[model samples]
Target: MRKLDNNEDGNFNKKISNSPANKRINLRENPYVARIRDETESMRAYINYETAKEQVRRIDDAKDLCDEIKKMSEDLNSNFYSNLEISNSFGDIHLEDIPDGLRGSVKYIADNTGWSYLSVLLFVLLSIAAATRGRYIAKINDEWLEAITLYVIVCAESGNMKSNLLKLVMRPHESFENRKQAQHAEKLSKSNNVDIVIAREIALKQSQKNHGKDLVICKEALKTLANNVRHDRNMINDYCPVEEASALPRVFTEDTSFPKLYATMQDNGGGSTFASAEGNTFLHLVLASRSPLDIFTKAHGYEKFITETKRDGTKILQQPFLNIGIVVNPDIARQLYSNDRLGLHGLSPRFAVCFGGKQDEIVEDNSSKSDYNSYSEKIENLLEDNFTQEPSRKLIEIQFSPEAKEQLLIILKETEKEQNRTPKGQTHYRAYLRKIRGLVARIATILHIWGHAKPDNHFVSKNDVLIAKKIVYSISLHAEYAFSANGLSAYYDAQKILDWIKRHRHSFFTSTQVAKGIEKMKNDNIFPALDALEKLNIIRQLITPSKPRLCVVHKNFITSA
Candidate 1:
């Protein structure tokens, strides 16, 4: 309590600080101890500063991580939406997608038969072409393109009313064939009278001739020969002078041998459709041969070629147009895709395919009962024009307008880019891209005829090309899907997965969970199917601490369910 000198108080403070209990109170009072404590205090301040700095750095790191995650989520959403836009389903083609001229037929057939609009559209196009092939050609720029012909394969399961669909669409064609065959029968009977006269005259002359003398020396025989020459003046082979009766007129054949197909083509004057509801039967007939794609490729291009047979010697084909339209099961289509020869020989590229998906129930509309009458009338008119026109007249050439040509050029450029982007493994699909230009032009030509009142005078408009591109885009996507290694099998598995998800009402699931949920499906099947759905933007994967392989179903898919 008494005041003291600095040295005395410092000694006292030191003594007090030396005692452990009083150090807290007296340490600051001793100058030496206070200096030592200040050094320790500075070190503690440095450690506190370092710890605070580390915490601030961690906070900044966490901010960066949050931003990275946000960017990734945005990127994923962008890609998912982009893919959805790029790869639209075949059933995505709506009424607006079809041209006004053909929309009625397409919708009618689709509604009645439960076929996809794309399927019915392709069939109608093929039917029109089959009815009028060789009557019209397209002049796209300098290229003299052949008539609109297609090798279309609609992949669907059985009991899809393919036969009824075919019968309805081909009614006009069948009617024309029937009428022609009737005419042919009447003509054949009259022609047989001439044949009988010739045969009787020849028999009489031969009976009159002596065995020892030359048969030609007889005056009566010479007279009969001259009479026979007069009767031989009948025309055949599209108006070539011949003695034989004319071959039965035909537009298409369902079941025929390869050699017989060519014979029919000859009879029809170089155009025919090898169409069938049972496509596997047609496939088996065509593919039975070692080199099946040869004639098909040649005919598709309307190329001239000569084929020799054992009895017929050399048969020359002038300009053959072969259109094949078939409805096959998805399994058969996969077999076609897997055929190395078909793909490599370019037949696969020539085909336009449509995979039939889930069909909606058929709802009968009384208003549309007579919708097919207009279609039939148009088809019959085309057929009449083809048959009534002079054989000597050349094909009516369909040209494109300037705007259409520009649109086509744009499409060609885009196709080139697509070709460049296509992987090497997809050789046939790349070839398919290469063939798109011709395909578009052919479709445009057909659309021009279907859309215009006077197709012979009018040119293919830019709108025609745009519609053609829309159709071709859908078709190309289908081709890409079919050509993929997974193909229709993956599509099937994807449907199964969707069904299972719907049954169990799964909002989030793993591959293992899906595999377990699906009956008779192997674990290997789950990944590809899930991947397909993911690509389609139906579901997406999530990573979390609790669930590593978690996938959330798309809100749209869930709501639709």
Candidate 2:
């Protein structure tokens, strides 16, 4: 009976293999199989690299160490992430530890956003976490209470639901504005406009003259006046009145000048979020006006930012609280970082970046509209509950427990090793590593608030520390991959070798066959080049543990042929 079953199974498989649908696999034309086959080639790439390294060592070359360095760089550029999958490199950890109130909503959006919901959640929570900026502090040790505020970047491609998620999660800020506007209209309806204009002029003059405590009185007077008389076309940096500026009435903005940002934070008591769904929306403006970067880099923490304007040498002092999130796709990322200004200016190190491949397809949800509505409502409720907290009440501080402190140090040391192991020419990698430990601390604070709605706890728990480390590790890996995307053009040279395999019309080929087919490529470069092409999923090798490996062309081998 077993023999008969085996024979039947083998004949059934043989019939399927000879079918028309399966014929494309033989021609290497089916993309789905091509993707699965790429994973196998990835392994061959690592083996080839090791084999080449061994051979390179055994050779007594006339070339010096500099020549070897150049060759090594070329090899790394061609097969950057082939050896390790960035997705699973960090291993797994528990991601279901979201606050019970927000869990269903988080999962609902995660189902449809076409983004890693975890990534989306991190961005969303950090935006909301801005409220806890100076209100709650952390004690790493016995010395001081550390203010925890993390700034994150969602580096995803366009049309990946970044904007939709931002719109959905950021509803409370808009709601708050609408509520406030109604209140303002009721109070200031019959106020005189001439009095307001006179008040603003007096306030500006007094601010310039005294730079003193009386400026507060002047600021408030101007704010009341400005609110009564609305100006649609307000000047840059002059958009908000000095008094009402920092305490932002409108919390979320896609476009804002540095002065406007400063005013928002100031009015909001030094705590607010600035988020850009598309990276290019603000980056182009930022790059053109370079001075804002200096202020933003320091304002993420409690440190005071003193910016001196070139226009009139006006000095602006701010000890503001700011949390910024930028969603950058590959095209914008390359353009932003390639100029080297952000790195050179020492600002790139401040952000905790979430970058990698974004989802290309949307996940379909067949759930009823009520289910979706309930999810959005829960998220809004979470934000509303937090936002409506007593603005004038005493609040307790948050800290890391002794064990959590030790755990944090261990994670810092792990990051330190990564910093040291980073190779030369990738100096920005070392620069960005400086902020990882700090970011971990801030993320721990976020989790603490997220897991427990109220800040009743004194110390961060062991679970929070564990989750924070996982977030850091993932971001660091993606950062390395994102910054190194520039060197990938070297992989294009592998196309010549792939074309040669196609021209021969052989089902399988050996190194000799490749050599015979390629009339132009030099003998010395052939093997190393073939190794790179294989790594890039341009070709594959049929595995035979006891026999010589045979070359199998990738399904898209003749793409440029």
Candidate 3:
């Protein structure tokens, strides 16, 4: 009878292999077998359903079988199939025999549930254990082998699971056995760090092939696995691969020894090395450092120490580190260092050393005195030897109106009084005025080139001098001929005067025109004010046109004013 039953079983298996529904039913009897059968059937259905309609119902049946198979697989132990060579015999069934509909259903179930069963089971057991110690376990089979099977599944499917599994394990549970299993599972997940990494690599490859839609799913799986591992302290410290944990996406282990990592990063040449490993380059690792000082120090040290160039011609040292924070005080630096060495990881000794120095003293002491002396000598030589010819001076006539002339005299007297009131012993005061005059002369020449008259240069008002100084400083700061609208207007007026002289061949404005122009200018209050220009010898009155007479309309007058 036993031999007959065996023969019948063999025949039934053969018939099931040829029949889609029968095959799915047989697979649903064993969880592992059911999972594989569901996946295979679904994949086949998906491939064939595109061409056939009758296969859709079969696909739905296959999906039902897959779910049933997954539940059984989670519930069953290896002993349930100990007598059967399940792994070897399971592969012999022809998935093509399954109807397209059943195959599609199976594939969907497998794709979604195959990797997540263990995580779900663990989460349930953990939750139950938290509520009632023996009540949950006593109600179900507390088989060790069954639990281990679930553990293996958790590790294998870590890449596909959710981070919630981690939280579940970390939560307090009543059963010590359940807690131990959770802890073990968590550790295994972390230790299997390479699984998610491989998943990510596969995802990236898929993305490169224009399969970006699959990237999010793959990335989520990888993140889930990493989070599960990070939730348990024991798992984090023991089973988690320090290097691989560091490599995992979103795995932030602050306790990592960055200095040690940096030292490991250093090449034989004393420079930082960006050696390639497991899809990440040394440059990638260095760039991942969160400590600014660690980043800076590593970057600077890498540049100082590393010698190899990447395929793209970028040196390892060239990679920038992220999460940089400025060290304001050494006290802060010391505190950061004491609390966490990684916090101080990227700072350079030079930066920390110079943080306390006086800005002015540092600048003065660092400047080369010999270089300054050489520069001064070059300037004196240029002034004396090269500039031997006097600058051509055009005489400008100035016959200010009675009111304008009176205003000029009053301004001049005020300036002279201020000069006299300045401390007599202060040579710097005199030097400052001379500097101002020189700046005004140069500014006027520039204005003439741009076709404008010099604006008011009177220093009688401190505010006026400050405005002028700002203009000069602005030009110097930019190292270019930058001027405001007012400065441009002044330049245009000076150029007009130059143009007038060139066009007239030494003619000057008549006294009435001069008076009218001055009166109009006074009303506008454009700078350098007329009085200031005359005082600086930028424009003066000519005594004569032929003999250079001191007449308001004379060429000398025009040139000097």
Candidate 4:
């Protein structure tokens, strides 16, 4: 995310086209550094010159380690799935497995733009589920263990056609809802018995306690009634938000204030999706909030969440039905990753993150708006087909086949073992494996429903589970990419110092000279950063009887930078 000036581009890490496969090749021609660049091209990612060099070196080191693991796993078990050959790209999704009508459009858009097919395809799928989250929870034990709600994020540059692609994907869903909300509102407006009076806010338990009656029974009855009433409402994503003193309907909000979003969800049915391309807006909201998003974290586990707001003296026993999708930059990605480390509930980790970069300039040939409509309409049509019974419809329980469970168990065991062998600081993101199993199950159920993969019994089959594995593996790679990108931000200052050292050609510089180079370097971190640079072999330290202790920049760093 660092801005590169023209002068800086001379040795700016031999940049590559930012695709998921991320084909390692320099953007501009450079005959002098071509040999080293070509040698490192296949392994390095687009990062600071030194960091990318370090990454290439580390990758070279890991090849031997991977070889060791391969040998060990082969000796222990031949069916080990995580290997170099299989770890090709983020993941490969068979277009045939995708629900009909989605593959063509998603692929078309991705192909036309500099976006990955998997990234675009997954975005469309998650958005579909997001549009239809409420009234349709995928169940595993007939008890709705799988939330069916999803949170996915893809980080890319602004010019990467993120907004355009989203607009095309979202068009049909929004259009369908706009029409449905109109019809529902019109019908309600015409109704004579519709409740126009606002309900008074008084705790029934307090009243029952005052009356010397059983408060528990009263609260229980209230809870049931509240749930029933909320369910009975026409809960669909409303484009126009309701005004103050009016009931706020369900909405697919983008970059909204949490408090307003929270209130809107409560008014509608305590479920909503926040899908946004402008990720910084949400970051700004979180930073400006009175407290961090506890609801978001609690929602992941569907924990016993309660919110009592002082503004309206309102209390809500919030449900864990919220979904989110956002496109973010590296700065916000770093911030979210850091915040995830700070909290016990861990809002940031709950999100399934994917990263994207600029791809080759796509063919100028474009798809028409109507073509976009055709794909989004397929999603809308599927949503209607799933929830045909409009008013009082409920989620259908889709059980997993017995064999599916066995397959899932095997995947879980292998994934956990693989994670155990992961290098330190990288495996922290694997903690979400506790939830990912259920998430994969939910996605399988969703795919079954969407694809209409007709089976003898109303249960998810092994085929569905297999598809889920591919999806989950892809998601894991994305999580690794995103979290790793954020980790690089911690060394931002160090990378800057490296750049300075390489540029200034300092063979032997004192602390005072370092001060002259960087007038405002952190007093405490300068020495540690220098030590780190030395450890990375980007620089070396020397001490002599005739001279003060001085640091010398590595000779190759100048070329590499």
TM-score for all models, in order of appearance: 0.67, 0.59, 0.16, 0.60
In candidate 3, what are the lDDT values of residues 53-144, reduced to their tens digit? 65777798779756654553343232222111000111111234322222332222223333222222222222221121111001011221
lDDT of model 1, residue 143: 54
The sequence of per-residue lDDT tens digits that candidate 2 reaches over residues 1-561 is 345588888999999999987886676876777887998899899999999987887564525434543443333333223221112222221346554445555566665665665676676566546545445556676674455666677665455667776665565556665776566564454343455656667656554444333434677766855543333214312633333311325455444576665545555455466776776656755677444676666666566666555763543434455667777665565555555777777666666766533443666764534544654454455445534212232335677887888887887798789878888677777888876776777777777775665655556887778777776776676677545532211122244555555575553466666666667645344555556555655455544465444555443334333
lDDT of 4 by residue, 184-211 (tens): 6765565422233122122333333444
lDDT of predicted model 1: 0.74
Q: What are the lDDT figures for the candidates, one per model?
A: 0.74, 0.58, 0.30, 0.59
lDDT of predicted model 2: 0.58
- Ranked candidates (lDDT, high to low): 1, 4, 2, 3
Question: In TM-score terms, which candidate is top?
Answer: 1
Q: Give the residue spans of candidate 3 off by over 4 A.
A: 1-499, 503-506, 510-529, 536-561
TM-score quality measure for candidate 2: 0.59
Cα lDDT over the full model 3: 0.30
Q: Model 4, residue 138: what's the lDDT?
A: 53
Model 3 residue-pair collision total: 56
* Tens digits of lDDT, candidate 1, 1-561: 788999998898888768977767765698999789889999999999999999999999879756654554344443343222212365458888898878877777777777778888888988878876666788886754655678888887766777877787888888888888898888777655765656655654554443324556578878876665444433122233223576788877764566787777777766677778878766776566464566788878767767887986776677777788888876677778767788888988899898763376675764554667888988888877775312132567788899999998898999999999989888988989998988888888888888776787898999888888889888888998887756555766777788888787776677768766778776556666667777777777654454435577765555567
1 versus 3: better TM-score goes to = 1
Which 10 consecutive positions of candidate 4 have the poorest summed lDDT? 79-88
